[model samples]
Target: MREITTVGVIGLGTMGAGIVEVFAKAGLSVVGVDGTPELAERGRGFLEASTGRAVAKGRLSEEDQAAVLGRVTWSHRLTDLAGADLVVEAVPERMEIKRDIFTTLDGIVREDAILASNTSSLSLTEIAAATAQPQRVIGMHFFNPAPVLALVEVITTLLTDDEVTGAVRELAVRLGKKPVVVGDRAGFVANALLITYLARAIRMYETGHVSREDIDAAGKVGIGLPMGPLTLADLIGLDVVKEVCDVLYAATHEPSAAPPALLQQLVTVGRLGRKTGQGFYAYEKPGSGVVTDAPEAVGRPGAASSVAVVGTGDLATDLVDRLTAAGTTVTAVDDPGADTASLAGTPVVVLVGGPEGSCEDCGSGDCLIAEGVDPSDATACECCHGTAPEAWFGAVAESLDSRTVLVPTDEPSAWALLGRIDPEVQVVPVAVHRPTRSGSLVEVARQIDGDDGAVRSVDATFAAAGFVTLVTRDRAGLVVDALLYPHLNDAVRMLDSGYAGAADIDTAMTAGCGYPQGPFAMIDEIGADEVADGLTDMQTETGDPALSPSPLLVEHAVANRSFLG
Candidate 1:
């Protein structure tokens, strides 16, 4: 009800200090309190260094920076916040620590002063109930480097007053942030989608389905994300990522939301991402982003001389064009029987689940339709798209005698089609996800049942043809789709629950996680019907309930509607 002037912030860690910087730079008096004088002083250093950087960057004048510094009164005592109109706790994410801070602030700050928790995933309802004035308690979650990132999740519990929510939203806008007001749900919006996706990536790596570099690269190169999930987890601190995973899992009871053992083990050891200098990737030192680990040696690009492409789809056509431009003799035919004589020596490419035109920002194993490379080959069609073509299979593979069969699919059914081939075929299960600004990602299964020579050729050929290539084990969804679809499902579920609108969720992801497009945008681009069918197929293959399509997704698919519209 009153104008907010003096603000008190508890805990002056990286996030806490950034919060202090945001408010102080906005020309408001701030009191930043930590547990000890030393920690409090450390918090001061964080604020001063941040402001000093801004001055150096010419973003902030030295005089204004000094004034900003003048407004902040750092302390180790809670009593000093008596005059503050609002107090925000940025303590450790543990419940007891936050509860203690809220209880202390309830007794210290004025009754009208709003109490907010800068928690990423803890239950705001439980945190609010710790104090007598639950109406004033809310969640003001700011992403890391708070002064930089524009997303602030303003969360409200049932007890949180509308005025409290409005004031926080107003302050967030004043501080130059695009705030998404969400209910008091675990992980709220951003982390709910983000952390679960990160957990899936971790599980993929843990199972040795894909390499660490490739996992990061698939999302970065294939999906056009700023950083891959594993890289983000490392940057955010694995411990923090794991904590949020626990919170989300506790709330949803979804296995995908739970932290993988590898993540927990890494945190147990002192490898807490860039902070400790050793996380998924080896960094130069603590707090450094420079990765010191050697990238896996890949086959030289453009190694293959001749290939026969026997598929129909935009992705396959793109591959044919790129490969042809790279000087590889490509024998591509829409009819499998049309080019059967030339398929003996050349590698045969069966493009499965191909859409003539798709959303520009499709991601991860997004196979929508089976292009009739073998128009009459029902087995290949039925295997990938779950529908039989007019003609049965085997015409495409009739000539290949022990030659490499490159079947790019969204699932492991590539092997199914190749298995039906009578001859001894070296099946290289290829996975495709296209949505990059510059290139696409072609992921292959590591040589288990697949031929090592064929795998090596694929890496060389796809990479040389201007695509990101990753070779991993023959997992159900390969690399990209394994982490992507479930995340989209989570977004759909979140939207269905009415926690946050689709536009707000999209903004949160784009602004907070640096994704090229949010989940809903991606779904609309890829087609809801196709995505739901893909999920259904993947769920049938894997039997993982996490892969099941959200009912909202199915509804949208059935109606041919966009999640955004």
Candidate 2:
């Protein structure tokens, strides 16, 4: 492989300047080129401002900052790249503009010099087709704020030489980047999955399924993402997100890739997210991160004063403690065998365990018994005979008359148990796990109630029970798991398909998205079999191929071996 010493960066915009800084900081001489002297100077100013901030924050000494600045030379002429070992084009997302630049660079640069495009979602083949030396052209796609991010996608087209790919990958490693080699597909790996997820969030918002704040909260608290999809879109600039969505949709024709109507409308009105101080949420100012919300048009629903907590074990204990701490009147009944008379006047009831018995034996007499039934009446002991209490509708008929019931069960069981309840009873199925982050709340499947105010009341009840709430539709995996499991399954498929190794895929997601752990690591932590089962169930419900569990995942699950092990 040829060594890369001097790098030439064209179109010194935000991405271009960051790329130049990354190379310069790695001790490579960089020629930052732009369309004119003014743009070149502006790019230089951006570089100086970035370095100055670093110095002010004590991230870099003054001497080191000066050295980084000294290594970069700004110019307006493409001919200045004649001695460059590699030329990276970071121009706008226009095929004609990029083709023109690559064509000019082909004539100006040395015969062996590599040419790369820092495009997030454009076709490398089409860009290379404009040059005579197509075999030398590849993609070195970097994440935004390239100097701060570590992931570099090295895209290889059909005509791209193996040596050229290897050289670029090596150069990325030398510049403190984790490079993953991928095919020249639209959005590649990260953005392909990311765009689909973002589109789903927008659809959820547009359809009035959940509030914007709760949706964002779900992503942050449920999964360990650095930011929610909408907030990230705002930070990324909605205009750019729309463009990428358009490019992906045009390439794959996947409905999930199409930009939602709401996104387009926001862009049309010039409310381009944080860049323009408005998008999904209002920002303090243009390019600001601080967010503020106007007073909600509808007021919050009233809170419930009294709640009955039933079932046994740690989950029940936690719920009782939380409810007690929240200052709500809590009637704690650990014995499911207790008469329903104790739960008569409670306005809300939280069932902690699922339909199946919470104890070790199936015949454990822990089911909720009716008030007037004799304990020895075999006919009325359906719960002890492996039937859920909700199945015995007559048993809880009195309790359900005027009260709201909250069942915190697994996603698959939520619907089945909820379906058995009387239609007149207000029931909400919630998937509650131990909080992943501090102050994170449980996810409430709100479609069961079909009223925003009713859902809010349930949310308030949960709050009174000492839990935060994220309201979502009564979907198979709820919000967090629905978006999260499919992405993990996709990562597994990527490993199974030989696109990349487990370690590399893990590295890519963590470095690319600021996730606390990569997909494989999460799979191992969650148990391979559990992850596989969840994906299989989701796939069956949604019919999305992305949700299908990889065969490797199934095999590992069957063998009870960790992916990492």
lDDT tens digits by residue: candidate 1, 1-565? 4588889999999999999999998889999999999999999999899989989999999999989999999899999999988888898889998898888787888899999999999999999889989999999999888888899999999999999999999988888998999898889999999998899889888886567888888878877788888899999999999899899999989888988999999999989999999999899999999999957665584367877665566766777898899888887766534646566667655545333312221222243225545423344332344322122224555556675565645432342244346547766667777658746788877756666777787778777777778887676566676667778888999888888889999999987777888999999997898778778878998888878899999999989899887
lDDT for each residue of candidate 2 in 322-349, tens digit (9 for 90 to 100): 7788788887766545676656546677
Off by over 4 Å in 2: 292-301, 336-340, 354-408, 411-425, 447-454, 464-466, 489-498, 520-565
Mark the regions of model 1 whose C-alpha exceeds 4 Å error after superposition.
296-298, 308-317, 330-344, 347-425, 446-448
TM-score: model 2 vs. ground truth: 0.84
The C-alpha local distance difference test score for the whole of candidate 2 amounts to 0.78
Clashing pairs in 1: 353-369, 354-369, 359-525, 376-391, 378-392, 446-472
lDDT of 1: 0.79
Tell me how far candidate 2 lies from the true structure as C-alpha RMSD in angstroms.
Answer: 4.8
Considering every candidate listed, which one attains the maximal TM-score? 1
